[model samples]
Target: MRLTQHDATAPTGMRNNYVVMRPQNLSVGVLPVHDDGSVTLVGQQRFGLMNYSWEMPEGGAPYDEDPIDGVKRELAEEAGLAASHWREALKIELSNSITDQRAMAWVAWGLSAMPIAPDPTEIIRVTRVPFGDLMREIARGSVRDMFTVATTLRAYHMAHQGELPPCLAKAMLASVR
Candidate 1:
């Protein structure tokens, strides 16, 4: 990441110099859900936050590459799982005022185990929590990663609003109650 200074006019017609952070690549987040309404999560110490965080598997993708490809790799590498189904959950700009980091998130199912291959810098712990339990933790502030939080909430919305498959949505909603 790098910061670049730019001269810009504010909404109030004031001119000022602003330093903006530029991220190198687009990022992707995946919420891997099982047939039983459990979701896979990866836990690791975040360097920027200096705290241990549990988040849905997420990673960066180059601008020239399909974000789905990056999501597949992240799921396999961080959670040791692969999905036969995929659905786009959200596309968002994170902290848009400070950084130009955009992310795409997906809800993946039809999960099967794969070989885990984490990056050399990552010491990740993998876990599967029920959908409802995950939501509870998020509300309680234990799971604080924005990507994960957003994706999970989107998935819940999908389940309720008929965006997700009926059977899968039923299972997911059942877990919540």
Candidate 2:
């Protein structure tokens, strides 16, 4: 992350110092759902926070790479899941006021087991939980990552609104009550 200060005029017609963060790459996040309506999450100890966090499989995509491909690689490396179906769930600018980091969120189903191959520096624990349980965890703040929160909520909305495949939406929304 690079931070730069620039001379700018505020909306109020006042001169001000504006600081901006320039991020090098865009990011992608995937919410992986199984046939039974379960979602897979990854637990990892974040070096910045020195605490464990549970979040959807997410990673940075180089400027030249497609975001979907980057997220598919993340899903395989972090969760050991291969998805046959995928949908764009959200597109967001993460902390836009401070940085130019953008992210794409995806919902993936039609899953199959695979071998995980995470980066050597990462130690990730993968878990599959019911969609409802995952929702509760998000509501209770156990899952605090912004990418996960936004993507999961968007998936829930899509499921409720019949934006997903009928069978998949049915399975996903069945546990709501």
TM-score of each: 0.97, 0.96
Give the poorly placed runs of model 1, Cα more than 4 Å off: none
Ten-residue segment with the worst summed lDDT in candidate 1?
A: 168-177
Global lDDT scores for all candidate models: 0.94, 0.90
Q: Report the number of the highest-TM-score candidate.
A: 1
Q: Which candidate ranks first by lDDT, i.e. highest?
A: 1
lDDT of 2 by residue, 1-177 (tens): 689998999999999998998877788999998888889999999988888999999988888998888899999999999999999999999898777889999999999989999999999999998888889998998999989999999999999898899888887777766
Give model 1 RMSD, 1 decimal.
0.8
Per-residue lDDT over 18-73 for candidate 1, one digit per residue giving the tens place of the 0 to 100 score: 98998888989899999998899999999997999999999999888888998899
Q: Model 1 TM-score?
A: 0.97
Tell me how far the alpha carbon of residue 151 in candidate 2 is from the true structure, in angstroms, after superposition.
0.6
